[model samples]
Target: MSIYFWGLVISIAVYLLVGNYAGRKVQGLDDYYVAGRKAPTLLIVGTLVASFLSTNAFLAETGFAYDGYAFLMLALVAVNTSGYVIGALFFGRFVRRSESLTIPEFFAKRFDSRAMQVLAGYTTVIGLTAYLLAVTQGGSILISDVVGIPYGVALVMVWLGYMVFTLYSGSRGVVLTDTIMFLLFTLVSIIALPYLLGEGGGWNATLTALASSEAKPGIIAWHGLTGEGALWSSGKDALIWALMLGASWSLVLAVSPWQTSRYLMARSEHVVVRSACIAGLVLAALYVVLLFGGAAVNLVNPNISPSERVMVWAGMNMMPAFIGTLLISGIMAAALSSCSTFLSLIGFSVSNDIIKSQQWTEHKSLRMSRYIMFAAALVSLILAYFQPPAVMWITYFAGTLFASSWGPVAFMSIWSRRISAPAAFVGMLAGFLINIGAKLLDNAGVLSLPVYLDPFILGFFSNVICILVISRFTQPTKAALAYFETIRQTPKEELDPAEVKKTLIWPVIVMISGLTIAGLLFVFYAMPYAAAVGREFSLFSGESLLSIGYGLSVFCVGLLAFWQVRRVYGRKTAQRATTR
Candidate 1:
């Protein structure tokens, strides 16, 4: 076997060992479902990032950048990641407060609707299975190409690698191993970036060359390529598309079953909030590097077929043996992390929410969940075999299901007093069916959608319309209203005086870091680009504003977070004083 193959094998072996070890502690459903609800900020952050920064991001989305649209993807990401903060603040903390094992159950609890729970679980299975297929396919392709394995065999290997740990250890195993994988991939992303940049003649020369190259004109332009056959009609269209999908994806970050479900494992609401903040920061940094590497690899070799192999090609051809090995393994780690996460969630929904397994004996429930996970993994493997890899689009399609279906309902569930269970159910169903149906039509060429008013718009509007119309006609159930009130209160565990004090530090650190990054960007990124473009490298240049604008956005997020947290804390203190 190649060293890369051995590296992947060893990585899987270690993760298997770690997962089995975690399984030993799974005495009950709590341990299996949500890590006994005791995961700290670090573990939460690790899983959030690991579960998210999968092969879909590394291979599929990065390939989109390599195909031109690097900065456009970055713009979309900046819009999407804002959901982390909004989600953490509004939706995720309440989820932790509810103490549900799965997001489906959270909906069931919030509205007291078992059918809604099952429907949510049904969508979860369908959407996440598609996502799993994409990740598996991406991993299989990487292994098949670089590790010299047949695609069929590689698919099975990828399936078994994640399924073994997930079936055994559940969330306990997933979180711990996910953290480890997260660290590995994060390190490789940092280490591999400079090498990729150096090969492309550093950022300055690479930017100038990409901008000027006649063969791939506008490859590094603000909106990426434009005119005929471009991804969009024009630069403005690209911006609108980025913004539009960016908003949809933002909702995905907010209330996607996979993203919000991780909160159910957090130690406290504070951990949920802190982890979300940190994950947003980490993603901002990681995507810029990862996407840049994707665009930069064109300089190394622009003719890479399928574009998904750009990173792997650059790793093998441009870097040292060990670094290349590590890079491949890192990408593999990302694939496995998402696979395990999605697989475990599928099983949790099947056994817990779909089958109502809590009524069974503890041993039977655990055994059944494992069996269900194995079944889900097998299903995904079969799907992977037939589906030629279209990793990025597959992911985007799956992701839209949640944002359109769950996003509006999620926030309203926490804050709205009148959204009835029936209304929510219709809204969720309408969004799911409309978005998916439109996507199918669009894919089949029965109809085409503009960049701005594509499938997501149809589903999102349908959801909102159904919700508003139905909610107006039907009053909320008393039970639902009471549950809403129940979750709105801060949990006793999170209200500790010292903990509140610690939270104050988060906003301050975030704001300062944003300012520092903005300042550093002009010095490092803007000035260099300006020099390379034959323009005066000045503080007031348009390039400088680009960095500064992003930095200010981060600073604003921190400021808003700081203000809200203080207001909440102040109210809590006053309530206590009045009670005394």
Candidate 2:
């Protein structure tokens, strides 16, 4: 077998071993669903980052960069960072305090309604299954491409891997394996980027070539009037892009059931805060490398069809075959990590929420979870094998479902006292239906919506309006109000004032400064240079100053991340010593 095949084998072997080891720790339902709520800060951050950096980022987002949407990198960074901060601040502590195993359960407890729980559970399962099908299909394609195997065989192998790891180990195994994969993916991507950039003749020549080529002129333009005049017509498109692509997607990640489970698994409220910050920083740094690498591929081989393959092609062509194989394995790691999390969440929804088996023993519940996991994996595999149109059409469909259905409800549950269980249920159903209706209309060409007018915006607002209107007419139950007050009064361990100042306050300052500087660099230097580049820009010239500038900005952000992690962990160590 080739080195590429060996890399795949080793990756699969490591995941199986980790799953077996973690499976031994599964003593009850708690362990299966939430890792017994003992996961440390680093582990939580690892899994969260791993789950988010899936094939979507590896392929789809990278393809955008290759197609000349580099500005999206900045937009995504801003939106995702804001999302992490918002989630950590508003949702993380409250949800973790609720001690709920799933997002639907949190709703049920918060609203004191079994009906809402069932509705949320089914909605999550449907939305998450759509996402899983897409991810699994993407993974199968990647494996088939790399291993030279038939798509059908690769599909089965991918399915088996999902079943083995997630079925045996549950959340504990999933998170642990996620952490390992996150590290491998990050390290490989980071190592592969500079070589890829070099092969593209550095950044300057690449941009110049792209600018002068027959490809869309807007590919090189960052902001303002594009050379094509249609790609980003005005600031309206930019705002819409930021809102729908950046904010809505981030909102889904922030409030999604699969993601909230990570917050619930955290060891403490402090860990939740620290993990969010770490994840945000790690994601920011990685995106810098991946996005730039994708754009750089335009110079190495401009004719790479189906732009999504640019990253994969760059890895195989730009690096040694062995290293290339390892880099390609990172894509597989991304796919499996994300798919496993979704599968686990789907299983939790069915066995824990849908079944409503209050009388069942913990042992019985754990066994049922495993059985559901196997069934969910089988369903996903079959869906992928058939290559349904939903795979392509459901990108925003799934995000809109989660964000519209749960976003408003989750916000109201934590922050609003007037939201009744009935209102919450009605609001969620309304949002879900509105989103589906809009999607059907858009897909059928009955109504053509602007690029900015996504289903998420429609569904979210519809849900909010329904919630506000319905709650005004319907009184909240006294029991629900009382429970909300009790949770509100629960004494949370306050952060040490000095530690907070150093870790939290300073990191925020550093991040804002880094982003501001990066933005200025793009607006003033990089954007103008790309627009002005003519035939004079040489391919063999010295390193691109623009590329170096972007790299430096990324480095500054990364530096702040390292500083943040060290400060938080140092404080954690000091606190442990004091307790001892």
Candidate 3:
């Protein structure tokens, strides 16, 4: 009856349809898990976007923007860029070549140890569950806020909807539905950005309010160690590190078990590399919009009661009632796309890593994965019902654990040949335990250290130190050497060097256009802030014609890329490879 409920219903219907459609293809395990490994670049791109940008992002990113003690966009830019580059440079080639279904499979093959496979699998399952819990928390918060329903009830409704889609369709459903959901979500933001900017006094009033008020620093300022509190809190440095090295390392090395699930869908290394770069740039641009929206909210209405309501508040204030409903639907779509993947990942991990034995066949394995899905969703739902109101903390813990626990193992697998099985096992153990221990210690006030020195930072170094020290006493396995060889071996099916060289022109153009747009957005924010304090620039004026020029550049590059794609398609007969 409420707008939130209606939005929820519409989102549910779309997902259900996707599930039903995808179910027709689920003849066995492969289709259920990785869509028969035939996913085109577009669907893979959608799933990547949807899975990473969960409800927590919608809430925390905007909340962080409104918190105004940090330049959230800069952190986003750093981490995302680092993650993409890392993926493109190293992990992409390794993972694409392995041809494994799960991250643990890669580990098992690389390390020649079933134990390492099991360890990686369980660690991913547990870590990702925490991440999903955080995502669900944000979704529940939105539902509760809109319909005045209990959090537990809202959580159940959201979880049940996710289960129907994930269980029936698995990753196949995730890819298809995510594509639709991503488009809807992106459209909502694009539509809302212009309308909100116009209604909130054409950016002038918002800028003045943001600059003059003392509620918080603007979005570009550091988040921690304010006027007097700088002596007590390490939020500033922690925020910066989280955005920079932390994001990049975690994302790039993530191909192990976490992102291996996504890359498995891509047909070749080239597709994965190109898609990741494009996705990274697109996410960066989206963050700029979301950052602007979040900042604008605080500028127009400095009352930050419930942090999660930043987007909702802006929507209600700026748009018509009907459009407000559509915005909420967009949020629901974003949340659902993420939740589906979380469910699928948890299920797959539990089935393949925990319950099923190595002797199991494909059909049995797939069935077990579905059961794991049910059990995981049920456990998370129960946890969500009792979770504390601070949804952001859970998300932080999840990200920290994943980054530290898997980051080292994944990095060593590709980067080093000397890392032994025993060393890998012990390193993962030390990293996982140290990370958890660090968090517990900090929370209990048992030790007083910089917050940045938490489990993530500690565990990362611990894995490295443990592996290096232990490997000195151990021998490398044959599988480890084999994996190294695989990395060295050039694929027979790789794209033609000459053809790829031609495609390079478009990607370069796109990159330049993307960078130029980023520059304009930065200036957009800076000029408004400067103008609020009555400072005017000479000659170049922050509001110069260059912004429009950059916009046109993006269009031109897009056209060029389209033409290249068509030309490549036209030359398929001549360029087609003669061998697999």
Candidate 4:
């Protein structure tokens, strides 16, 4: 057998072993759902990054980069980082404090309505099912290409791997394996960049080839570029694209069931906050490397059509046999991490929220969770087999669904007391319906809506308007008002102001220094150079600019990793000493 096949087999065996080990520890619903809320900051960071940075990063975004839409990388980084930052600053502590098992449960409790909980639960399942389908399809395509198998067989294999892990280990298995997968994928992704750049004869040569080739004009342009112009228009559409995409994705990260569940799994609010920051930084650094690698892949082979397959082609052709095997394995890891997360979320929503099985024991609930996961996996497999639209479209659809249905209600529940249950329900419904209408119209070609003004933007605004307008004409129940007061008065752990200042000092310095350097580079070098070169300006050249940027990013990421590891282990050491 080939080395690639061996690698695949070994990786699968390792994952199954890990899942079995974790499965033994699953004693109750608490352990199954949120790992008993004892996960450390590092584990939370790993799972959060692994779950969110799935095939979307490896497949979709890389495909965009391969097609010379490198600007999408910037847009994605800006939006995704903003999402993490907002979640850490505003939503993390609140969600952690709520002590809710799921986002839908939080909504149900905050609104004082079981109906709202059921609605939220159903919506979560439907939206996340769509997401699961996309991830599954992406995984199948990658695997089928690598193993030289039929798409149907690959689809079944992918489903089986994801479902088995999810069924056995639940969140515990998911988080543990996610941490391992994150490390593998991050290393492989970073290493792949230099290899591709080298294969393309370095940055300048790569850019020259891209510019001279029959690729899209302005393929190197930072603004006004897209994969299909489905989510962004051309020319003068950059600002709106950034705003809508940023806002919509940010809300999804803050309020989506799968994302919010990570916060609740944290050991403490402090861990939640720190993990968010670390995850954001790690993700930003990784994307810088991965996107650059994807762009460089065009130099290796510019004619790889259906662009999504470019990364897979690069893995097979642009690297050594062992590295190629590892890269494909990393892609599998990404797929499994995300697929398992969504499966687990669906299981929880159905068993805990929708059914509301009060008479079941912890053991029974655990078994039911497994059964639900299996069923969800089967459903996702069917969807993947039918072949969905492009992965990014489905991703955006699911993201919009979550953002419209849950975003406004989540923000209002925590920040405002005047939003009645009726208002919340109606607003959520209106947002959802509007989003559906917009999508149908766009898909049917009945309206050529500017991609910048996508469904999420419209639905979000609709939700906000409905809440404000309807709440003005309605009264909140006394019980709901009391609950709001209780939430308002919930005391959080206070950090020392001096400690906070000390923690802020280094990051503030680093930010200022980095921004200052960037400004100087742009003002003195990039602008003058670009103006001189005119429309032929090559952004990838100029004294190894891309190399320097990527190097610094990697260095910063190393420092962040070291700092986090030291902090976590230092605490352990101190605790051991005290015990002695």
* Candidate 1, 1-580: lDDT as tens digits: 7788788888888889999899999989899999999999899989999988899888887887888888777668767877887898889989988888899999999998998899999989999999999999999998898877799999988898998889989999999988999999999989998888897678777777776666666666547778888877788798888888888988998899889988999988778778888888788778878887888888868888898888878878888889989998999989998999999999989888888745699889889989999999999999999988888889889998898999888999998999999999999999999999999998899988888777888999899899999999998878888999999887655656677778768878778977987787667667666665566777665456657866776777778777777777646855775887
User: Where's the lowest-lDDT run of ten residues in candidate 4?
Assistant: 490-499
Against the true structure, whose lDDT is highest?
Answer: 1
Tens digits of per-residue lDDT, candidate 3, 95-184, equal 767777677777888888889888887888888788778888888878887788888888888888888788889888888998888788
lDDT of 3: 0.69
Q: Where is the poorest 10-residue window by lDDT in model 2?
A: 538-547
lDDT of 2 at 523: 51
Give lDDT: candidate 2, residue 185: 91
Question: Best candidate per TM-score, number?
Answer: 1
lDDT of each: 0.85, 0.75, 0.69, 0.75
**Candidate 1 segments whose C-alpha is farther than 4 A from its true place:** 357-359, 526-546, 574-580
**Candidate 4 per-residue C-alpha lDDT over 397-449 given as tens digits, one digit per residue, 9 for 90 to 100:** 88878888788888888888899888999888888888978989999999877
Q: Candidate 2: what lDDT?
A: 0.75
Stronger candidate by lDDT (3 vs 4):
4
TM-score of each: 0.96, 0.88, 0.88, 0.87
Clashing pairs in 1: none
At residue 63, candidate 1 shows an lDDT of: 81
* Winner on lDDT (1 vs 2): 1
Q: List clash counts for every candidate, in order.
A: 0, 0, 5, 0
Output the lDDT of residue 190, model 1: 93
